[model samples]
Target chain A: MDNLNVLDIFKALSNETRLNILRWLREPEKNFPAQQAHLPKEVSIEGGVCVGDIQEKVNLSQSTVSHYLSLMQKAGLLEAVRYGQWTYYRRNEETLAKITKFINEEI
Target chain B: MDNLNVLDIFKALSNETRLNILRWLREPEKNFPAQQAHLPKEVSIEGGVCVGDIQEKVNLSQSTVSHYLSLMQKAGLLEAVRYGQWTYYRRNEETLAKITKFINEEI
Candidate 1:
């Protein structure tokens, strides 16, 4: 729960788009495709939701979503995995917990 | 711990200055005046850390610190109180807890 680290985590979650992306990841099937026919089902499941599905749900261009995901991943709020042509993203629960505890202890 | 509300809190803490302000508030006596001779001790105590003290620690202009405080207060991260000529601020623990829980459950 270092003060500087907590600040970094909070800075990461500050954006409206990144915050929404994390929320959407909570229920991937509802907010994102469970399977994309063009992509292998196993790939989607093993890798998590693809960037295209996230882009569509977020109503942003593929480049924009990709950028946002990269930023969040750098901030340690998300984990990225690639399966062939598509990239999938999921919330980083460990960092998420650390962030929550940091806020509780430091703030 | 609504998503929008959590977003607001995160946005408030996103700034380096505002984040430092919260950390300073954690140990008021060390970072701020215990009493100002020009002002009432009770006023400083009940009202919390004066804007001037915060300005000094943050190394920002009076107007800038005032603006930052106003923004954080609006985002529910701080509580402000005025007594006589000076205003003081304190962290809003309830909102802090809500934010922590929101991240744990939603993020």
Candidate 2:
């Protein structure tokens, strides 16, 4: 695990759309059923949803969603996995735990 | 407890100075000993440190510090108690715990 930068995490979460993306990722199966249905059978969707699906759900431009996800990934709030041409993103549970610990014990 | 406004709390914590202020508030005796030493013998300093002491410690204009403190207080990250003419501020442990729970359970 890398050192968690508290300021970066806070900055990544400061925007409503970015925050919503995190929440929506929390229950991907329920929130992104359409994306799940269209998954390639050979490749598991277990890693998480692709950026295109996330963009569709959030109703934002591809570039904007990618920017938000990039910020979140850099902040350690998200984990990205690349499968062939598509990229999947999911909540970084370890980082989230660390953030929880920070709030509980630190500032 | 009030409905924890996670977005507002994130916005409140987005600044380095504000974050440092919260960390400094964690140990009033160590961080603001001078303020502790100057407390009126009759009045209790138990609530927290005064605004003036916080402003001096942060080395910012009174208005800037006040603005920062106000934002933190409104976000439920800090609690302010008015004593006579001065207002003392301290971390709101309840809200902090709620935030911890939020990150653990929610996003």
User: Largest TM-score belongs to which candidate?
Assistant: 2
Docking class of 2: high
lDDT of 2 by residue, B44-97 (tens): 757498899999889999999999999999999899987777889998988888
Residues A1-107 of candidate 2 have per-residue lDDT tens digits of 23999999999988889988898888897888665444568767564888988999899899999999999999999899887787899988888888888876778
Which candidate tops lDDT?
A: 2
Across residues A1-107, which tens digit of lDDT does each residue of candidate 1 receive? 44236566677787888888888887776777655545654445543677888888888887888998988888888898876787778888778878766777766
Task: For residues B6-104, write the lDDT of model 1, one tens digit per residue.
Answer: 667777887778888988888787778744545654444543687887898888888999999999888888898876787778888778778777777
Native-to-model Cα distance after best TM-score fit, residue A42 in candidate 2, in Å:
4.2
* Model 1 CA lDDT for position A99: 74
Residue B80, model 2, lDDT: 90
